[model samples]
Target: MDALVGFTGPPSETLLRSMIATLMHRGKAPGEVFLQSNHASLARLQLSDDHAVGLRLDRRGLIDGDVTLLVCGFLTRDGTESPGGSVALSGLIAEYRARGVAALARLQGAAIVAIADETAGALHVARIGAGVRTVFYGRYTDPSAATSRWLVASEPKAITSAPAFQAAIRPAAIAQYLAFSFVPGSGTMLQDVFELPAGHAVTLSADGSSNLTNLFPFEDGEWDGRGDGDDHSHWVAESRRVIADAVARRLPVGEPVGIFLSGGLDSSIVAAEVARQHNHRVLTYAIHFGKHYPNELQFARSVADRLGTEHHEVMVNPRQFAPRLRQMIWHLDDPIGDPITQPNFELARRVSQDVRYVFNGEGGDPLFGGPKNLPMMMQHWYGVPREPGFREKAYLASYRRAYEEWSRVLHPRIRDQIDPERDLESILAPFFQQTSVRSFLNKLMAINIRLKGAHLILPKVERMLAASGLTPLAPLFDEELIRLSFQMPPRMKLRSGDEKWVLKRAYEDDLPREVIERPKSGMRVPVHFWFRGEMRRLAKKTLASRHVREAELFDPDRIRQLLRYDIEEGAGRYGMRLWMLMTFELWRRVVVDRDRTGVSGGR
Candidate 1:
């Protein structure tokens, strides 16, 4: 992966060089630069990635006077690629003359840019969308240097590479990760560092002050009330147009692109659009569990055959799945406890041999709404949410594990550090209390959109794909498409019990009725079956490792129940919980213990 990391205070050539050296191991490229300015030291590493277009811009960081500007990730303005031709920070400043960060914030795509200017006496950073691409920053006091320094990096592992930086796993974040499978909101595993919110810009002044600017999130009390009564057919047409535009914008120019064909409505819609654009000669990839596995390779084959595309399939099993944990967890800098994560990794690894970029249809569920949300919404309509007892029960209904389950598994000292009820309430508060979100369905969608898609799914896929020497793009995550989703009324999102109603209607003509009507069983990995077989030994050994035992995160007896084949509870799903715990322990060993072989940082 290409690297971009810098600090606004103090000059340390060693620190910047250390970061650049780390990027070399991830991929091979010569887009490297090192400059030590009077006020700060900066380093930028832009590796060879064909899937993303803006690395050339990153490679050409502007060194105008006392300022150094470095950009990472891709950007587009009003659906048009930015810095159109031979443009740089100096060019932007000369043209716009107002720092240009405001214009950067206005750009709509997945991007993060950092500019450090001594003349301006402040460092500026901006992210394009909600956590699809973002910056993680922190301020720590370095008494040894007799100065306090604030820093930012693409990943937390980069910050840990600097001198005086020690990696410590935050217990509160651990509790959230254990309960939700992902730490929510701004929290990270590190103590003083937190991710800069998506669609925001941060300016850290040389005088030791920082300020933030909101770029993409909907304002509190925000409501368009525009699509409240639009005609159904018209809305469907509009939805199709919006989705198509989003996909087209993300397609890399002069780069070979492939589509992830899953035989589901969202993926089929994406594949059909690619086919229409390419005159039916497309490169498509799919993954299955072989004959004994419950997979939809047949349906995927049907879609590919109808489109007349060259389709390739990767058959994955327990043996391949269990062995890649160390590297897979390392790529996923943050622990995301999803069972499908492994398949996403293996698919990207297999696909990278031929393609530079692969597009997957991911945002349809959260944006257009999806099935399996009916049960969650039932509580919202039929039960009283404000009641203290009811709220806790409802929250747990959505969470993976409960305190009772943890009580048996966690050390008392570790268990006492967290309050699950309060933590979960804080994360869900934004949606529950927003007066503008009138529909129960929108509230549910909002929670999932913010946490599930942004924090959990996107990070895992993006990083893992990059780790495999390929770039991953989710066109469905475009800001324009996401904004259009909010414009549609809730009824169109989940009409009656038919979830993602508008999405199905939009592509009904292009895709088969059976594919559109099928229930959302989503890429099922045989996690349960694996746990019953080969994965059982791996899970047991990892959970009982010396580092994990010394950390005292779990009880030996509770670990025993998980290690044994038969186990189930209201506390957690046997396979899923074991996965979460196993992943967490592995993360602590790799990230917390600073094991160099396990994790690849901007060293």
Candidate 2:
């Protein structure tokens, strides 16, 4: 968590010291600076004194005036023995210049780097592929030109201040965030601030006067393994190999590594792999809401027993759920609409008390079609979507929703885009512009990867652990694993009614047939029922308050109606939409409002 800020203005020893001190808590080293203004200004904090490469580079920053880069790397609990030279900062410095953009092409670990040119004042900023590391930039307003200097940091809360930062929340992004509960791609919750897209970088000139130059581009459907005879079976084998490799790379140090085992196929498979490689059994953790939740204790226990891993199960009640909500929101740094965010936050906190690292299954769905929507997608693709009245049925469910709800949950624009009278096939045509089923599936995968896949997993789990100063790993998100998943044939990934078939096939030898055959039991938090039951009073008060009504972001009347009305017969998927909206309002109140007071600036 090291931060370096260099100003082109005349050097001020005292001011520089104060700026370095800003990063003191975030870093392990005492804050210090070396100024040769005409040369380059450098402030360095080596979060880990053991990792001395940062100290060496901090020295170079003072002498070299061509390019200035600030890098911060976080080692999860499991990363203690990451092979001596794997994370060397000097190698990264050399890679940037020698290998150019390719230097980070195969890089691992959670890290963010900002490279600045002292002479030319050019900056190249990026994060690791899965965005386990975060880098955000805001334009510092300057009057000399129509532009401002680009300020970048590791987190949004860090740079959302400085008088120069604009707090305009991107509207389109807000809609997507509501739908996905996480912002996708390079966009951030704030309008001016942007997360450097994963596996990508941007180059900006020193004077802060230049259009963004994308150093990495999103390339999909580019898997060429097919020509090499790596068909579906080959891909299944490769998937297993990559999963093992990724897990081995992130196993815990000192203590046993922890796993967020849900007893579902995803985490079960991950736990099995960890058990196979290491002597110590992986410690699997789960937060349960008694029997009302996923009822995963029995299953998770069974897997742990079979693999001889020690399992810790904590049953959670409402008392444990309340206090952690704020902490979770703080780490997520974004409006996370899901109720499970609370549980995941608590799970990380509990794990952080003892374990430094935990591995979970996050990206399994998007890459391998493990989500329920896949069946819908498959049904639509084969012509059932063309049947009359399907769209009508979906839409009527929304209208039939209880009047207690105020606004309809569906995005108004998405709803308008779909003709109310049209069939499901016609409704989906716009989202999937491609006619080919495989191509459309890929596009769907891309959306999930951008939003639901990484969005749900990283922000909730990774960010939660980060808030607690712990490290969490998602093996399903490994770049090679994702590429391999794409290489698998559709049938292997999703057959008849079974999703994640390829994932199961990949680990057939390791897991019991019944474990692999079990239904996908998502971590449950009865938020839908809670909206109509125990939390109804709170929902009414929150939705009717001046904060929500006066803010006018969402229609108050509509919200009230939705909250009051019970959609017991099942309001189609209306609950998901309504829940998303409610979470956004809560986020605005908690995060966006406090952001206005100026405490959440510059990490």
Candidate 3:
């Protein structure tokens, strides 16, 4: 992953170098700086060849006169033209010079772009469609110069590198993380430091004023006019065509590609397409806990054998990677409580040795339907006691994270600062209240794609893979595929009870019968067993430490109850809550506490 980091003020070579040091793990190349009269920008070169996907060197210039353009990820044209081909970086800069922020609408794919306009006295940073790439920005007054400055980076650690930037924990984001297991919307766990949302851009002027704009709006009714009338085959054919084109656009030329096959529908579909299209050898990787635990290797092996792919399997356990926990969380920049984060990071470490680009079936669940929505749909139709804010409550509870226990787990001082309505529910209110999307199911889909997909799923994957110096390709989350999903009738996605029906129908013949028909039991990380067995000692020591107690975040009694599994209501489900507490506590030490020693390997 290539990155750009700088501020909107007089050139400070020292500050630029400090920010660059924070992101050196992203790339080993020397950092390049472009200094101007009003602003300065620094870009780190990519380790892999940009021309692997037809991206020429001239098109991706770091500086262009009064305007400096810096891109973090690759951009591709819509399938109406070349499938995986990239739009020239030079062309994007030219468009920005002419049309300003409006030119962003023409850009597609998973990338983030930052433009510094010395002539206009303004700097702009935008995240392209579906947010596969992330850009975080914050505005603070430079204490030395007494002038306003905006610090931006690909990861939060870069912004925190500046000595003048004071980093503090944001309590409201803590509440949100407990509910969704990841921070939702533009706000991050760091106070005043915000993440740019998907299809959004932020502009900063010389005087420190800022403006945020949504370049690509996610409204529904726009797709109502499209789609063939009730003809199942039409949707099947169209879905197959659109998905195939997406996969084609992401395949790197003349290099072996890797697929993270879970034997699930999403990864299987991606593997099948990659195997069918790539002329070079296709490699597939899968993980299992051990022989004692339930595994998906049989199904994944079936897919690999059918496609004749060179398959490799790896085993991950708590003891093997516990020492690297702090390093993994530091790489995440923000805390994501998913138990699979370690596995994803470890898998990428192995995959990077063989391939530069890896593809997975990430968007299938959020875009099309997956089994996670079934519980919410059931509660929507037949839950008891329809009270106010029932939908929001039901949706939050569906995550099965710490939503129900958030208040109990938090210390009173910390809990008092958070309001469920203003902080948590407000994030979902706009999507649910909007009448533009008619169907109830589509509303849930909108929430899933916008909140979970952008904030959690995509960012988690990008950070994990990027940490190991590998670029991730998610064709299912393509802009064209996203639009095509909305045009599809909701029933077409969740037919009767089967999820992702259209996807299955599209590639029924290409996959094995067992693979296609088997219900989606995702790669379930055994957190519960680990808490009682392998990770038990580590969890107990970390959660009960003096640092955790003095921070006044979690109640000591509640932590004891969770460790003891004494709570009757959530018995046998305390592992997830303990994991969330452990992740946040560890993240707080490295990020907010500024404990550099903890980042390498925690005790």
Which model scores highest in TM-score?
Answer: 3
Candidate 1 lDDT by residue in tens digits, 1-603: 555677767876666665455445445565766655776666656667543443234244666776676666765555445322223445544432464567665566666777776877788777767557656777755545667777777666667666677777777776677667777666787787777766778888877788887767643333456645657887798888887776666666665678888998888888887777643236889899879878998788888888777899998776886667777776677664776788888888888788777778888787877875787777766865575545445654566453346556676777788776665556776677777777677777777767777777677766777777666778787777777777777777888889888888888877777788888888876776777777887787877656456888777667777767446444226777787788877777777786656443423
Off by over 4 Å in 2: 1-65, 74-95, 98-103, 142-147, 163-166, 207-233, 292-294, 384-438, 454-456, 566-579, 595-603
Residue pairs in clash, model 1: 18-603
Candidate 3, which ten residues in sequence have the lowest lDDT sum?
53-62
Clashes of 2: 22
RMSD after CA superposition, every candidate: 3.2, 6.3, 2.2
Q: Which ten residues in a row have the lowest lDDT in candidate 2?
A: 52-61
Clash count in backbone of candidate 3: 1
Candidate 3, RMSD to the unseen true structure: 2.2
- List where candidate 3 sits over 4 angstroms from the true fold: 29-37, 40-44, 54-58, 62-65, 79-81, 84-86, 220-222, 225-228, 383-385, 598-603
* TM-score, cand. 2: 0.79
lDDT of each: 0.70, 0.57, 0.82
At residue 458, give the lDDT of candidate 1. 73
Each candidate's number of clashing pairs is 1, 22, 1
Please write out the lDDT profile of model 2 over residues 1-603, one tens digit for every residue.
344444333334543444454344443344443533442334555432323221112232322335455555532212233322244455556667777655555554455555655555556665655665555665655333334456555556555534434466565555445433566556677767776666567666655554443332333433433564425677677788888877766665445678888888888888998888766647888678776645668788888888888789887765655444444555566766666777777777687665656788777887787665554565466745655555334322322322222225433543344333332223224335543334545556655665454445565665566555555667777666766666556666767767887788888778767778778767767666666555556566656746655675665555655665644445644555555665566666655665332223223
Per-residue accuracy of model 3 over 271-319 as CA lDDT, tens digit each = 9899999999899999999997999999999999999999999999998
* Candidate 3 lDDT for residue 521: 91
Better of 1 and 2 by TM-score: 1
Model 2 lDDT on a 0 to 1 scale: 0.57
> Between which residue pairs do clashes occur in model 3?
84-249
